[model samples]
Target: MNTTMNEVYVILSTYNGERFLSEQLESILAQQSVSIRLYIRDDGSSDGTRAILASFAQSHAHIDVEYGDNIGVINSFFALLRKVPPDAEFVAFADQDDIWLPDKLIRAVDRLKDASKPVMYCSCYKAVDENGDFLWQSLPPEKEISFKNAIVQNITTGCTVVMNGSLLTALKIHQVNTKNLIMHDWWVYLVAVCFGQVIYDREPSMLYRQHGGNVVGAKNGFALWLGRIKRFFLYRKKNSRIAQAREFLERYKSDLSTEDSYLISAFLAYRQAGLLKRIRYAIEMPLYMQKKSDNLILKLQLILNSVH
Candidate 1:
């Protein structure tokens, strides 16, 4: 079989997103990659989200909509994952409120095709308001990201990733059976870094929307930015978020023997609460460490690297 020209599946999950649904769909359907199929799973939205989906499905033969049992967003996406065709060469995730670039699929697929990597992800242009105003950006280099590193810092933007069939294989093998694994992107990234190759394009391809109703609104203004900086150093000092991430990493690390140890080391460092352990771990990887790295050498190196 000629797998090179196989179909691409954009598995999109939606809820009550009537306001931005059409725009998102338009952006996706307008992509230059025309051999794409939409596998949409709507989570029993009471708003006009279903209507918008119906309209798009009626007008586009490539679009197929599936009704989910109101099982919330994560489950709705998982439902689409289960229903994805066996012949899908590539799979990309889509949110209900983002505007994709015209060449999003083309660029991602081309990168994945040309490189030795099996997965491709890009950065996002965080659009906050009607003017497409700038919010912050997430353009962390892909080389610095991995399954272990993800536990310390989430560099993989969910909506900007394009993965291959290997992700589906990992999901089936890992059999992730968590009731609270609410973040699908993190899980998928984990699978990619663990069992497959992931290539990240530094270019931004999606217009990430931020609004009042979002689960976690984009941090805006100086005060919020400063607050985020403050919390970056202080949050793990007392909160359980770090512990939770570490636990997830530990649960899945056994599956990544083929990958490098960079991610695992980072995760272990974050899990350790002792200053001595953290310091020792930080010294070994002076150029890169997790949020909790507080060693003097690491700190000095970071300053020197940025002093120019």
Candidate 2:
């Protein structure tokens, strides 16, 4: 592939990330084999993040900064996605503090270059500490990547995600409800599986920094598992996976295939079904997370109608 012909617009949303922001920006700038235009939106940082971004934007013609109010991460990313130029051939999301590998953009572009329809490419990551020391590498998804799995679990890490022009165009067609989303990347994965294709690469693409300020860190051990258990028991109704799926169905019901439409409708119906029906749905639905243990928890959540 001619790397010069592939222009990738990377959208990054930052909040109080001044400490490692410069390093992240430099790594992105040093990406090999592709033309990159970095677009950043600072989510009302009280630190030196704005000044740092301003300095970089002033020095680099390809870097653009938007000093915006604090709209949270999901909305901030969605805002940046909306601002992506229509002529852009590819789009990728970036984190404020993670050091992207030199081959990140090129790898994504290579995977998506042949796609003529809506398609997204995402990969695993090597988790690192605040000082960029290796922690652990995230495991690739063991099960199939499909709408059923996406409805229940998100395997796509936002920083490793890249979308073709067709996928971006499909996403822009809908007025997305950021309030109903769990994460921008999760929603994108769901959409890609439902309406297009998702390519999952097992290779590590970046250094996923895990620190005190991480909104969502890499899942690797017992602590994360315990936290997930707690969250499952205390899950809120308005922001649960069911709510996200409901919002997705409402927006794209007419465009969904018959099987997909029924799957979502049945998933939603579990919230109001009786004990027997809920149990039956739990046993019958093909929804699953990546791990068997997590799949068990998901089934329990379904049987108890705890997803809502």
Candidate 3:
């Protein structure tokens, strides 16, 4: 463990993650990149999570663990960010249940060597059970990562990210709205996209595990199949969820930029709005101005044809 190369801190926030905490910790600790540090914050886990962490920290000199009240996940993460040592050159977020590939940090550091960017993320591949194996791969792929697609897809997986310390220094975590914003990753990505560069390695670097305890995961294949049997109902239901997300973004419009504002506006107005709303806004917003050109054309055609 040479202290010479730029140090990377792995920030992990745990809350009742006892079932998989050890595996996640080991996966990071086993990285070939020795210029690394592990920082774990226990969010008042009632489970044996804290005890397990204490046991592991005793042997792993580079691993540091802290305890705090049962604050929400976002707060726990921001609190971890606040504690990052000033000398740590890189910071990565870790989920308590995922397994990082041995070369993840090594490759990430290697990629960032000549990069002018402040943050980098890798593509994610799913590791799911038979119940929901096919959901993620079924979604359409963006040709590349950019501010435009990022607004919709948010391709950067929280656990796959590594942020440069320069970016962290510029971050004001406490000022962010912890209530409406779902997770720390979303805010981190938003900031990176807003003020710095975000690069990605188009490869999956971690086994993004799915279980009942996960906040979000793939839908059962059986359910997807059953939905196809009732296509109309399924379509409406999916549309409703997209509608809800857009509504949330709209309510937070004042918090975002015009460029970002329009992206979500089009995501709702052109790409996702109810037929009538789509038609009305399409005629109102300029064709070239909307980022999703294909969707815009479709909506404009619908507007001309008087489709409601």
TM-score, every prediction: 0.75, 0.97, 0.71
- In model 2, pairs of residues that clash are none
lDDT for each candidate structure:
0.65, 0.89, 0.65
Q: For candidate 1, lDDT tens digit of each residue in 165-279?
A: 6556556554454453636776676566655666777677877888866644445468565755565444423323334455455566675564444555553453333555554
**Best-fitting candidate, scored by TM-score:** 2
Kindly indicate the candidate among 1 and 2 with the higher TM-score.
2
Q: Which lDDT tens digits does candidate 3 get at residues 215-283?
A: 544444686456434533323322232343354464445656787777656655555456687657666
Model 3 lDDT, full chain set: 0.65
| Model 2 vs truth, CA RMSD | 1.4
For model 2, where is the 10-residue window of minimal lDDT?
231-240
Candidate 3: list runs displaced more than 4 Å.
1-3, 126-140, 218-278, 282-308
lDDT of 2 by residue, 181-292 (tens): 8899999998898889999889899999989899887766797887787778765644778889999999999999999999889888889899999899888888888888
Show where candidate 1 strays beyond 4 Å.
Answer: 1-6, 114-117, 126-128, 131-138, 180-182, 220-254, 258-308
Query: For this target, which candidate reaches the highest lDDT against the unseen true structure?
Result: 2
